[model samples]
Target chain A: MNRIAQGLTLVLLGAAALTSTVPTDLYLNWVKPGFGPFLIAAGVVMVLLGVLVIVAELRGGDQALDQEDVVPSGAAAAGDDGPARSELDHAAAEYAGHTGDGHGHDHERAPGVAWLLLLPVLAVFVVAPPALGSYTVESTGGSSGPPPRDENGSSRFTDNLSEAAPGEVVELDVQQFVMRAWVDEERELADREVELTGFAVPTEDGEGWYLARLQMACCAADAVVNKVLITDHPAPEADTWWKVRGTWVEPEGELYDASEHEIDTSSVEAVTDPPDPYE
Target chain B: MSERTTPERGSAPDPATSLGDTIAGGWDDRGDELPPADWGRSSSSRRTGTVWLFALFITAMAVAHAWLTDDLTGQAFLAWATIFTAISFQALPFLVFGVALSAALVAFVPTSAYQRFIPSRPGRAVPVAGVSGALLPGCECASVPIAGSLIKRGVAPAAALTFLLAAPSINPIVMIATAVAFAGQPEMILARFAASLLASVVIGWVWVRFGRADWLRLPSRTHAPNASKWEVFRESMVHDMMHAGGYLVVGALAAATLNVMVPREWLMAVAEAPVISVLVLALLAILLSICSEADAFVAVSLTDFSPTAKLAFMVIGPIVDLKLIAMQAGVFGWRFVARFVPICLVVGLLSTFLIGGILL
Candidate 1:
């Protein structure tokens, strides 16, 4: 919590931000793609502020002593519990008074909690945790269909599907496919051979598997699972990315409340993960 | 007046000193008091030891990095770490933006400017401040310190508190994001705006009428008397970031743990009940600590919940999430947050039900 520690924490955090954003796609694992510039800007500002703190401390040491003589008199005259003194100042004064004899610098120390900033810095650099995958999908009960339509019943997902010819193999994201299968009035996914890509999550029944991808609104923390239940195919190892050519198998009962949708696959191919993992 | 007029005379030598003099001259009237002298030689030896300690810690972490990553690849642990890191990374830039703005208020903007703009009376000022929250385009992370700075600059505490709650939720970016997330439901956007604004204003009034000044802890001013405004700006920015960022980490950790542990099915199971659904989602909003800009998508995904329930999620999120709670405790004393959060929650839920019932 001393000035040096505070400055170093900032520098390391800034460095972590810079490394995550600048030369790599590491940031995509955590946040959306648009935050790159903001991360970089913040990184620069943080590094600068940190360097300023350290430089000021090193060079202005003597000047600090000169000013200490002036602080207590002004603060005391402001009165111990007067409206003029902030609660923070009162706390600081008590802290200063308690440690006033040995640790003359206690007032300059940031709250001890500031040390916790180092945890994220260490987590980022050490763990380098991967993006959310099948574990998230399986645990979260995998993607619910898209947001409900307006009262007018306009479709948010099937607008582009109108261009697709019947019987053609149409490529779609796992999210788009789920929305069309469940809510689209056109049933654009029905009877069409649709190609989709996602990591695989085995069905709870152990019969087939779900091709799942996490759709993140802002960051991995808010990611929601979107998956297609691929029937009549062997489940791949969990989290393995695949492109599957399949046809939608309409559910027997009501479409809206069903827990999962079915897709009968004609083909499945192994593929590397996409550049942007989340939908 | 002379200081305002002769700005150029001070500019020729040191740009920082001149900028400091011109912008901070108003501060001179407040009776200068330098920051505590402990900032000087008292810590040199301790400083070296601290630096060495930091170096040792980093080296130890580097040594453990491979072993930890290898052993800690369990699914839940990985998910937890990813979410924790994501929340931290996503929130930090916004926190920095808040700190910068707050520091500028302390270092550059004069107290007189606040007096000029805001009405003196807490009742009138509260609503005006609530509406003005639309101007800040960022999320909740940016608003807390900005609110704290406003209080320090002599804005009515009630008004500043109003601005804090209202800014993150009613801001233009959040509104547009809500529109896009809810897609065709224009009413969702209107309802959120109305509910959040009303709730914040009501809470502000509650604070005004019954709130005690002693309960609030204004952020302490820190800078040497003769320090340049740039120095003040830099110092305060660093201090605020270190302070707030640490609490943000605590919030993010708690959120990640809950997010990983709590099953989505439990939420869906209760999505059928009318009253319980609203309360559960409201509580979930606090627990999830999802950013306001993104909470709409999360809300929209919970298609099983009633629209009013979704409205509760959106309205309460920016005002009283785990992260905001942690940051508030750091900025305002715990005494204030202890009283404020419960009242804010109740008012927010009431506003949501009223607006959502009428609109959705």
Candidate 2:
């Protein structure tokens, strides 16, 4: 791969990382807000280095290319093809910094596998894709039951759900509502009006949508769907972010059954997805 | 070949005094013209028609940007991309941390420092390297490139390999995290430590005895060029970042694809058979590739599975995964990963099972 190409790709990748992480949108899709600053710093460093590589090469510092360290010996193996070996040997010989054949850095070979590195850069900057949506919800069987324990493996409802006077409006997350419903023996939410916010995920039965939030443990890869059903109401548009004023209606089914701990919405409003969409 | 250096291939040159001249006439037979002095000032520094290649990539990216910005984002693409970027974002800092360390060593420290501490014999170095894993606190991303850099500086490959596996799995931070996550069951912490140590050492010994020289494409000892120390540090850092970052993405993509493709329901389908449970948990370890420090929490929460199965998940998550596979392939090359990952999986499974069964 050409050293200049390597440098430019670095610059682009770094730039994309900087822009994507600094904004609030990244929180919507993958991870928490913890890694934003680090990514920005890494992006700055990468761009600086990319610029340096180009400058060094431009100043007739072809020796800087030797820093590329095209050690062809690594390409050798017990049973490799002759052409692959020769191509590697040729590439190695071409960039033999100090103790091999005497040709300076050559760009003629093209960026071989190094070109693969550019794919992420393209995906990041070009595609600039968004977060998990209905397709993921459908594929992964959506938020199922309450976790085996309060995510910590304890038997009791771990969240602090204190007594709210009758008709008092209390705000809670979709997860907290479910946890209390699953394990709280005190029936603290029996008569309290609780408001919760999440995006609308369509029910498999097509009767209504579940107000759901995805809980990411580390990053998007391990996100767990935590959803509460919305009943006695028409389903809003799929994946529509919602803030609903409602109270918990006792489910006709067992605990954590889609119907069991659902919210009976007195009022519902459709809103845009939040900056940090996942819970 | 010099007495200290291992003989590689036949290409040799007359007494080369400077790195510059060696690169200039190095491949005298490979007739590629040097771009003019003013070529440096050009917008596209690429020469000999490579500009078109760069231009094509940029053009394709531009078109993608246009199509993506029109509010036509698909959930599938968005989900895939989000997962992809998240993996990259997560790995970015650790990879940079590793590159910074290796770069410092390459730029600042004399090779003699490594030689003095690390044993020369492959057999003797394995345990020392494996035990030293307890000291490095970072995850797998940090260890892979460092191991590659060490091999470049003449540390035995066996030792480097041993440290690569052990550092991420058995480090103090990971052990402490495991202890905290499994508060009631102290056995998990000890089991993870023992199993990881056993696996790493076993792999090291196996490599010492059976690993083919060609299996690993050992890194070249790239010395800092004649520049300021800052320049040397920057150069080493940049170079390692480029190589390692590229492979890390490949690993990330494989993991993201698997994350979506394999229905998450499989996690709930735990068979009662001990062997099946072990295999399922082991497979989950490969797919999830959770950070070593936090995997204990994930494992302990899975009360439906046997403790032994959860133990297998704890031990195997850090050792083998699609991400680790891609990274190992990235640093050590696919040749090494081809044999190495399979060997690791088998040995890691047995180690976890044997140790976890006895302890848990």
Candidate 3:
């Protein structure tokens, strides 16, 4: 019965291997989810092991079955000989010793628990995490409109960037916007041109603007997708690279909106994929 | 069937009885003198030769794999990640523990002491083994050899098997890692705890009821004589390091493959189906075979999946996965692993679903 069960298992494994190909992880997950590659490979290996085990069990059974078929008389006597008897005695003694009382040695085996030390060992290997920064602002669903601009066609780093003294035109560094999260108070910069670098993401609203830009928080898990609303400009192609100088404005709400904000679409330039492409 | 018949057809005395003849023949050749003191030298040398050859082959294959490939795609990444994970995971702390623990057993404690507590009946032993999970803490790599030792010591097979299944899932290290991975989300910890506990208990119960002890043969064969405690410790350590390390490498290679090869955008599109999305994330968890301690971090990063779905993935992963199943099968009997794995899976999933539903 055990042998039959084993064989059945092998057949199942082989069948699974042969027919499945949404990729093993995908297949396994669809059937019974797990960690992708590791789980798939482990499953494949298990099937292989099942095959080997079934073969071994069948062979053992075959031997036992054959032994039963043999006639049981003088044939057995020939097998019991002088030297063989002594060897058997020795074997019995060894087996007896094993079954006897020196189990203290088993206590020695507890050292395997020392591997619990590995948790600390691993902690030492992976680097310490850093603080979350500006690159994450837009992605966090903070502002909803065009980013705020400065006097000289550049977006102001923050609403507090020296207030541009009424009429003085200033060329703001595009990189400085990374330090602050855009808020509604900065919406007065509308029609004031400012340069910026970001990748284009398609928006379903058809108003020609959507949340675009690489999201990053700590690592990438908390990555916030920044919503960019473009009303006046042509619809940017999804996944295309872009360099645009646009005015800041307040736009209507969308997904995960925190501080409702918008962007007045301005001069847009389609560009190539950027080097080291991320905020 | 044919192969089985052919080996037995040789005109030889019953092999067990012929052992005496073989010994006597050796004595006759030596003119009744005692056997040589160093018979082990020849065997050891032969073993070393095999080991060296295997090492050479592995080195050659690794070099070729690194240099020869150019167009790495989805399949390739999967293969590599699996291999890497398997090798590294095996070598990591668990390997060290396997050796150290084995050594401690051999040196400090008497093996027979186990007889005092170990139950003779599978029925009683199975639960004890499963609940023993509360005691030993670590992942599958560390639990296996310990289970093997328990078996060699005459512990009920079902009980030992239960201990093996539960130890990895409920270990403190794994739980803590899960907690860190989920960060402020308290429910993640609860789900993992509940799921792992439930799965372990179910598997233990099944083993007690239907498991056959005769299958635990390979582990018993590991009882070869070497030397002192240092030798046992060193040999076991080296053995586990190589074996577990090999599996870790396989696992990592598989994970890296998935990360680089599969298109994430396509997966995201598929994520629109919430049921499929949860299942997909769970599958990724298994494939990645991240150590239970680290899986939380990976689970947290998957932004597309719902928190409840991700919770299921985290909960189910450590207890059951492709890599763990494969490793367990190798160390334990396939029959045992097969029975245990399914039971655990069902229990783990159910527990996670209930907990996640309540929390999320």
Give the alpha carbon lDDT tens digit for every residue of B1-360 in model 3. 333432332222122212123233222312211223322443323323433443343344334435543333333332333223223423243544553575465445555576666677767777666667767666666676676556655566667766776777767777776665555567667777766666666666676676555444322222224345554444344334333433443444455445435555565666567677777777776665655555665566565677767776776677666667655644443565567777776766676667677767
Candidates arranged by DockQ, highest first:
1, 2, 3
> After TM-score superposition, what is the CA distance of residue B213 in candidate 2 from its true location, in Å?
4.2
Give the DockQ (2 decimals) of all models: 0.34, 0.23, 0.03
Task: Identify the CAPRI category of the predicted complex in candidate 2.
Answer: acceptable
Clashing pairs in 2: A74-B217, A101-B26, A102-B25, A102-B26, A102-B27, A103-B25, A103-B26, A103-B27, A104-B23, A251-A260
Off by over 4 Å in 2: A63-111, A142-146, A149-158, A163-168, A185-189, A249-260, B1-56, B115-124, B172-186, B212-214, B221-232, B288-304
Question: Mind giving the per-residue lDDT tens digits that candidate 1 earns over B1-360?
Answer: 322322332232122222123123213211111233243544544565676576666666666764676887789999999999999999999999999999898779877898899999989999999999988898899899888778777788899999999999999999988998877788889999999999999999999999877677544443445668898788778778877888999999999999999998899899999999999999999999999999998998888899999999999999999999998877675777799999999999999999989998
Instruction: Quote each prediction's TM-score.
Output: 0.87, 0.80, 0.49
Model 1 iRMSD vs. native: 8.8
Show model 3 residue runs off by greater than 4 Å.
A1-279, B1-91, B112-137, B222-229, B238-259, B265-278, B358-360
Task: Give each model's whole-structure lDDT.
Answer: 0.78, 0.67, 0.46
Highest lDDT: give the candidate number.
Answer: 1
Over the stretch B209-278, how does candidate 2's per-residue lDDT look in tens digits?
9986667753332233345667767765766676677777777787777776787566667646788998
lDDT of 3 by residue, A6-72 (tens): 2222223222322232222212211112223333343343334333433333333343323322523
Question: What TM-score does model 2 achieve against the real structure?
Answer: 0.80
